[model samples]
Each structure stands twice: as C-alpha cells, then as structure tokens.
Target: MDALITEAKNGDKEAFVRLIRMNKQSLYKTAWIYLRDEQDIADALQNTILSCYENIQRLREPKYFKTWLMRILINECKDILRQKNHAAELDDFAEGVHCEELNLCEWKQLLLCLDKESRKIVELYYFDEFSVKEISALLEMNSNTVSTKLSRARAKLKKVIRR
Candidate 1:
C-alpha cells in the first residue's frame, strides 16, 4: 500500500486508479450510509478520486494512505449531503417498490434509524469490521469515545429492531 501511495504521489495515475479501485467497495459502503441516492454516491466517489489525485503529493505518510483516502471520501459525502440539503426535492420514482423485490438487507433497513454519526460508527465497526481504535483514528475521535458510541449505537439498534 505504501509503495502504491508512493507511486501515486509521484504522478502515476494508473497506480492511483488501482488504489481507489481496491477500496471502492468500502468507499461505496461508507457513502451509502451518508446518501440515499445512488447518483449522489457516484458523484461523491468521482469527486473523491479527483481530490485524491490532486492532493496525493501532499500526503506525508504513505503508510496512512487508506485512512487518508477514507477521510477524503467522508468529507465528499458530507459535501454532497450539504448540497442536497439546499436543493429542491425530486419525487421518488421508486417510492412504491417493495423491499422484498429489491432484496434489501434487514440490517440496512435497521441502520436507517441511526443518526449519521452513529450510523457511520456502526458501519465502520460492524460491516467493515474495523476495530474501535481504527475507527477512532479514521474519525479523529478518542478510542474511548468511539467505544462508547459503538455501545450506544448497538443498544439503539437492538431497541429499534425489537420494535
């Protein structure tokens, strides 16, 4: 990963693209929690890629590339959310679609009840299988705080699912 980062930093576009491709699933999962619309996720991803390409040289620690990429993606997701907040709402064409037909996962439906921060914490810890310490580093929070939030989020998830 460090080697890839070094290559990307030195203007190797293919290496940069490959790096982004490798983390695409995780990035998309993170974006899904932030966005309900697929188009928004794509937009966020494109913006993230462009930003990373432009700023890869600014990264001082090559070993931390994955975390840095995630940080950029999170920011891009937040930006899309902010923009959507000010945009006029469009009617949902698929509002009547049945979940069963779509094969929507139970966990994804349950996760909708969480607030953004709690949802992010839950996704990172559970779906992505990132440890509490890793989540803290990605989110720039103290490890204790991350652990506490995870506990609270789990409690909230249980309560919601029981309903």
Candidate 2:
C-alpha cells in the first residue's frame, strides 16, 4: 500500500486508481454513515476520489494513506449532509406540511423519553452507527463510559416500548 501511495504521489494514474479501489469499501461505509441517499453517497465518494488524487502528493506519511483518505471522505460527506439538510428544509416548506398534522413517530417519542445527553448519545450510537471508540472520541467521553451509557439507554428504550 505504501508503494502504491508512493507511485500515486509520483503522478501514476493507475496507482491512484488502485489505491482508491483498495479503500472503496471503507470510503463507502464512512459516507453511508452521514448520507442516506445513494446519489449523495456516490457524490461524496466521487469528490473524495478526486480530492485524494489531487492531494496524494501532499500527504506526508504513506503509511497513513487510509487515515488521510478517510478524513477527506468524512469532510465530503459532511458537506453533502449540510447541503441535503438545507434542500430538505426548502422542500418541506414547498410541500406545505402543517406542524400540527405531523404525527410523532414512536421511535422519536421514545427518544424524547431520554434526557438530552442520553438522547444525543443514543442517536450517535444507533442512528449514526458510531462505534464506542468513535462516539467516545466525538463526545469526549471515556470508551467504557460510552459503553455504559449505551447499555443503559438500550435498557430504558426497551422498558418504554414494553408499555
């Protein structure tokens, strides 16, 4: 992989393509975490590939290629997420859905039963599918504490659903 990165940094197009192929699965999975639509995912992946190809020469550590690639992909995915949010807001406005007529989903109501902090934790863990370490780092909590909170949150949700 390091050799491939080296070749890519030297402007070898084939090596760049091979490197992108090697990280395709990881790139897709990371993009999926932030965007639901297939078009959005493809957009993010395409942008990531383009950005990596252009910047591969600037990467300082060949061994850290995957990490570098993932960081770029995450940034691209977040950009798409923000754009989607804005578009969806405009869409909802155009559709003229009344707030009063909107039904609260059981899942949303269940999440509301939790405290704000716990609600965020639950959303990051389940909805975003972030692992314990990822959530902990994002939330600045210890991994064990994140695990404990997730367990407690699950128990609370189950208890509520039983009613």
Candidate 3:
C-alpha cells in the first residue's frame, strides 16, 4: 500500500488510479455525508481526486496516505460548500435524489444549521465512521479537542433537529 502511494506520488498515473479505485467508496461516502446531494457529492469527489493527484507530492508522510487523502477530500468539500454558498442545489435529474424525501430534507436542514467545523466533525464521526483519534489526526487537531468539538456539535445538532 505504501509502495503504491510512493509510486503515485512519483507521478505514476496507473498507481494513482489504483489508489483512487481502492479508496473511492470511502471518498464518496465522505463527500456524501458532507454534501448530501448526489451532484455535489460527485463534484466534491472529482475535485478531491484531482487535487490529490496534483498535490500527492506535497504529502509529507506517505504512510499516512488515508488520512492525507481524507483531509484533501474534506478541504474539497469545504471549497465546494463555500463556492456554492453552503447550499447544495441538486437538480431534479440527479440520481441520488435526497431531497425528494421529507426525512432527508429535515436532516439536511439540520445539518445546514451547523457551522462548518461542527458539521465536519459530525460527518467524520457518524458518517465516515472515523474514531475521534483518527479524526484528530486527519484534521490535525488534538484528540481531546476533537472530542469536545464532537460533543458541542451533537448538542447543536440536537437543538437544530428539535426545531
């Protein structure tokens, strides 16, 4: 695995493609949790993959490839959110029609009420199934900080959901 990342970092296109294939599901899931809309998820995933390919060499720790890739994906999602005014506007034609259901709409509204960092923590924890330790490493924060943020995020989420 490390060898593949090293090769990809060295500009091996095939190795990069293989690495993306291996991690695509996780990447998409992360995007999905962040964006909720299929089109937004697709756009965020594409941007992350492209950015990872372009910036792979900048990764200082090759052994931490998964976390590195995840951080890239999170940044890409944040970029998309900022670019689109933090409002994921999905077309009716999109396949993964999340907005069609009332339950998903309520969930999305609740998520949107969260500040970006809180939303990110919630997504990384609940959706991506990352541990607090893993999230701290990926986000370059202390584990205690991550735990505190998660608690605050859950409180905020609960407050929003109750409304």
The lowest-lDDT stretch of 10 consecutive residues in candidate 3 is: 88-97
lDDT tens string, model 1, 47-108?
A: 99899899999898987787788889878887887876753221221122234433335555
Looking at model 2, how many pairs of residues clash?
0
The all-Cα superposition gives candidate 2 an RMSD in Å to the true structure of 8.7
What's model 3's overall lDDT? 0.77
Pairs of colliding residues, candidate 2: none
Cα lDDT of model 2 by residue, 66-121, tens digit: 76777788778768878766421101011111234334354556677776557656
- The residue ranges of model 3 lying beyond 4 angstroms of the native Cα positions read 87-123, 148-163
Question: Each candidate: what lDDT?
Answer: 0.76, 0.70, 0.77
TM-scores for all candidates: the values are: 0.76, 0.57, 0.67
lDDT of 3 by residue, 1-163 (tens): 9899999989899999999999887788777766777788888888888888888999888777888888888788878899878654321111242433445556666677667776767766765678898899877899999999899888887786567
- Of the candidates numbered 1 and 3, which has the greater lDDT value? 3
Best by lDDT: 3
What's the CA RMSD of model 3 in angstroms? Answer: 5.6
TM-score for predicted model 3 compared with the true structure: 0.67
Q: Name the top TM-score candidate.
A: 1
Sum up the clashes in candidate 1. Answer: 0
